[model samples]
Target: MHRFKGRVGLCAMVALGVVTACGGSPDPARPAGEKQQEQQAASRSGEASPGEDRAVTWANDYCGAVSELVRSVSEMPIIDASSPRRASETSGELLKVMVGGLDRTLDRLDNLGAPPVDGAERVRRDAVATYADIREHAQAALSELSAAEGPEASRDAVSSVRKPLDDLGGVDLLAGFDTVPALQEASRQAPACRTLTDADPDPRIDSPGS
Candidate 1:
């Protein structure tokens, strides 16, 4: 029910790993242990049924996959602005990495199917739809980036996916599973899986290579 406000740049940080980039601590708002406790209490109260445990587990697995995908691409060489050809090539490679990662992630999610929990059908449906949008839009953004002539153009091209990526980050797929402690903790660690406030600048996109 809580909506996060900010540019998709923040989501980029989540995908990219803010801690790795900024050498910063995790978001202060949701400490892991405390969040787990809260979620456990909620679960005990029957806010989320025991059957939903499987859904929570699946959600956590999905988040882990996303985290890995982001980390993998964030390590790629930054595009050099000084050389136009190199910039284009590097940008294309980065986009290719992103496309491949997203495709794999989406396919994995599809294969996993929805959790066999009561009242989880809707959450599963929405999560799948949102992920599909992310994949499609990311592919489109990759095309634009590949066609871009230079660094500035590539930056602009990459910016095109900001909205859809933001939407992907904003989705609350685990809304139904929130009462599950593990799911809550997992969501906290990976803000892209749900809504949350933005932290300081910790860009995923590295500076141009020297």
Candidate 2:
């Protein structure tokens, strides 16, 4: 009986050693990347145009708000819906309203675009683009979020993209573009603008309450 027990113990040790050997060293897991194929597939399905995003929705609202144009054209005011005079009149009035509305609606754009601030416009746009990019970074960050594998990275990447633009957006628009030197850099290339929240940027400082 003693001899039999000794043989069984020897076999058990050998089996344990073999199992450990086959297990290999435990290594950390790595994150996944956004597959290019997925991007292509989305494009095929009808993705938005390059540089187009929902971030700037105000422009559309501004256009819609200007339903009528009050131009000072000497043409006898024809009330025809399809007439050029009506179209021009509506267009001209709308253009005027847009100046003020744009300043209110797109304060961030106005700040970077109109401000004499250095790199304001470029910085502003790049910041906006960064928000769009962070959505992609989310897929990449999942793989690297674990500390054993690597420190959390994409949060910083996302913030890197959002901060500059958000900080600039915080710059009050009612103050006028003269405060920011980057005003020279502004162009009307942005799409219709909108905000996710109901936050209105215009401060009531200029109001004749005082």
lDDT of each: 0.51, 0.27
Please, what are the lDDT tens digits per residue for candidate 1 over residues 51-80?
444444455456544444444344445555
What are the models' TM-scores?
0.47, 0.19
Runs in model 2 lying further than 4 Å from the true structure: 1-34, 49-51, 54-210
- In angstroms, the error of model 1 at 148 is 5.8
Task: Tell me the lDDT of model 2 at 155.
Answer: 35
Q: Which stretches of candidate 1 lie over 4 Å from their true place?
A: 1-53, 145-210
In order, how many clashes per candidate?
0, 24
TM-score of 1: 0.47
> Superposing all C-alpha atoms, what RMSD in Å does each candidate have to the true structure?
14.0, 31.8
